[model samples]
Target: MAKRGEALRAAHLRYAPRKTGSGALHCFVLDCSASMLARGQLALAKGLLIALFDRARGERVEVALICFGGARAELRFGPAVPRWWNERWIEPVGAGGGTPLEAGLARASQLLERAARRDPGRARHLWLFSDGRTTQFPARPAHADHVTVVDCEASALRLGRCRALAQAWDGACIDADAMLA
Candidate 1:
């Protein structure tokens, strides 16, 4: 090659490292039911969600929330940066209704699927807080990269359905207290 010296001249110094923690989505499915209201579980769950949203914000990870109760589920936030989350936004989250776990999961799955279509390489995580009060079962979403289930059920007779759901999803299962810890 006659450009041996040209190769050396063409080399310019540029320093960059692989980017990480960007384009990540954290989908939280919070169970806001009468059972959750019994022992302030709903409050605890909301507190945890706020903390999680803050952490995700610090990491530049997008956060989304789905609250299920009253036989309905709704997305409270989004699969975008949680820049708009604050105490006012967190205050209006009401409780006292039937636990619609399946509906929450279904909505989350839809969000994950849509996100996958938009950004295939983006990381997606699902976090569910439930008392395992429902008999309905929802399948693990194929679009989610990971899932974590927290059983908010605090009683003498535990159904262990939250753990079962976690097992089915091939994800980690922990208690509400454990989650805080």
Candidate 2:
């Protein structure tokens, strides 16, 4: 059940006047870790990323990329279109060391927050790619309007941590195979 304020907001959005070309922002937080290399998950994710970039190129969406592994995270591209994105660029991304999923989410949150400040009405979506090997849990960032956690875990014994993370954020959760399908 929706609260009074939530219902009112939903009503407003439901009946609101349409605006042409209200662009959206897509923040992709990628996991580049040794675990992802199992079952060629990292390779599959890279392929998906390229496809996603191609789709974004056809639309009025701004895309950002954040890859986390080892002990830290870095924003390779952000707050703008990736004019140089291609297979060649995606090939060099290394996968090793710790998962650092928390650091990745934190960095993605920062980017989302900044984008929200610039355009509060613009749609902000977060796409997290991980196998959920980390032990850290972080609160969902408020700036992200929507979140989807794509679990890359391929082990026979699955922990379902990605689904747990999605539930915690009230977001969507899908495995890589499901997503690809």
Candidate 3:
């Protein structure tokens, strides 16, 4: 079963860019609110993040991570050399605290800005994984070339806000629950 899971994961890693364009620097903003601690959501989020990191490696896309919880945001991974991301380094995300979406987004924007300065040709994308239960929204940074929202909310009541935020930003919203299915 483990081997089969590895095989499936490997197969899923083969993602072709939808358009022939310059490579992008992808920054993932993850919400680590206490709510995420419900139902093994943190583990799932980490797995998805690792998978995305593998895809970024394959596509030569730079990657970074920003985690928000407890009224604070932190950059757990980098705008450093892209090779630094690995399973061991990314797997231990814990969930506790209030959702600080604004702070997370701001940190992500800073990372993206720095990456852009370091590599002007690379496109910038912000992929946010959240339950969207925050009291505040980050002002969308103009530097984000594209935004993708991964909604981890499973309950009907928890679903709408994330979707609404995604729509307001004119970005793509993916239901993480559906992906798990």
Candidate 4:
């Protein structure tokens, strides 16, 4: 009894409150197509990525990055914590080739579905940063709890594809220019 009482010291009694956003996951689908390179869209997208990462870091949520361009979609980051995240890490992600929108969404869907199978209670949010240059209007990721489409198109003649997709998916569509301001 004396030893048990000694173990309950103030030094070992640190209060740890349960955080509401603890199990939340944020999946970022970045479009690194050649279209994104035009009008500095890729640059803007990269800036937004940094900000979003910072926000995720502040909330202590897990994040995954999937970049699509040229011929394929690649998982650039993780469905893990952004502990050592930095702007320089995204510097080598060059933009070129066709926009593989379908491939990117498919990859993200696979990841989210797997995550769902692992933890059904975990909240998954998908953030798609794209110029909406592709002709393919793929299906929305059902595994994702929420979705946000950031339209990076800055051309004079807007196609409004991203906005339409966001509406169809019942998600938010934010303009890239407005996000920066």
Candidate 5:
């Protein structure tokens, strides 16, 4: 107004752009193979998920869920805020058939890629909850800024696939049981 020194018009009025802080997105990949149903690992995982979702809600982070089993992988939720997340939503996700680890990872990769393109400034984190029962090894998603592999393999004779994956991807590896504690 001072520079113009005249009647202000809509074209002359300048407003500074507001800055919204970069947000975060968390994508969780869960292995729902029949193996997970053994020893109640799936149930435990669901419990952990509830806890994690609560934490994400408190932090105001967006979340997505992908479950893999029965020769396929499905996106159970969205990359949006889980406002009404609850046990009822997770209860119907039953386990069966083979562990299609590669399929699950590929789906997550696609989702992360789309999210990155939509909001390049948003930070992306990938969480994998698996029993490591699969022989397939998938590449890490490029769009994920951080990755965490939750090793759910509770068998006495461990295969150590999840640890191997974490090491290969240079990501963090955490035990499922330890996470509950």
Candidate 6:
């Protein structure tokens, strides 16, 4: 089987650019809840995020990051320099606190809003990496052009939720574990 990177590269190559006149902006909302520590998924997610960032850079797409774990989410990276997507600054993410999907989604939406305000012509893409066990969903933002949910859990229940969430948002869903295969 192809590696995750290869798979992602292939998928990306197959992606058709949105017809919007604005440039593309890719935002990654990563779940850092303690459960991610169980199967080294956090590390893998971080690595994949960096790889995506590299691809975004190569394509000159703007990139940003938002991390959620505890009661709240944080904008760990930026709506600024796309070059700041370096993995070195990504702290070791561990699981423990409850998943704050609503918070994370809200923050991501806000970031995208800011980006749009700065450049309304830019296309917006959101990538969410999570275990899909969250209790809440933030109201979907109206501006997101596309969303991709990456499920990191190995259990059926979690995967189901991931798929459900993707469907609810009319977005693509990916099983991170399977992608790694």
Error of 1 at 71 (Å): 2.0
Q: Which structure among the candidates has the greatest TM-score? A: 5
lDDT of residue 35 for candidate 3: 85
Q: Between candidates 1 and 4, which one is better according to lDDT?
A: 4
TM-score of 4: 0.87
- Cα lDDT tens digits, model 5, 20-69, are 42679999999999999988889988988999998888888999999999
TM-scores of the candidates are 0.84, 0.86, 0.80, 0.87, 0.89, 0.80
Tens-digit lDDT track of model 4 for 1-181: 3346576665665566544434698999999999998899999999999998988888888999999999999999999889877778988888999999999999999999988887777899999999899998999999999999999999999999999999999999999989988
Q: Please give me the total number of clashing residue pairs in predicted model 2.
A: 0
Count of steric clashes across candidates, in order: 0, 0, 0, 0, 0, 6
Sliding window of 10 residues with minimal summed lDDT for model 3: 12-21
RMSD of each: 5.1, 9.7, 14.5, 6.1, 2.8, 14.3
Evaluation by TM-score, superior candidate among 1 and 4: 4
**lDDT tens string, model 2, 11-67?**
454454555427899999999988998888899889888988888878858999999
Better of 3 and 6 by TM-score: 3
Candidate 4, which ten residues in sequence have the lowest lDDT sum? 13-22
Which is superior by TM-score, 2 or 4?
4
Candidate 1: residue pairs that collide: none
What is the lDDT, from 0 to 100, of the residue 98 in candidate 2? 90
Per-model CA lDDT versus the true structure: 0.85, 0.86, 0.79, 0.91, 0.91, 0.78
TM-score of 5: 0.89
lDDT of 3 by residue, 1-181 (tens): 4355465655455555444336777889999999888766777788888878877887777678899999899998775436646677876778898998888988887887777676666788899998777768666766788999998876546647788888888899998867666
TM-score of predicted structure 2:
0.86
Task: Sort by lDDT, best first.
Answer: 4, 5, 2, 1, 3, 6
The local lDDT score (0 to 100) that residue 97 gets in candidate 4 is 97
Colliding pairs, model 6: 22-121, 33-95, 34-94, 34-95, 34-96, 35-95
Stretches of candidate 5 exceeding 4 Å from the true structure: 1-21
Question: Which is superior by lDDT, 1 or 3?
Answer: 1
Give the Å error, residue 160, model 6. 1.1
Error of 5 at 23 (Å): 2.4
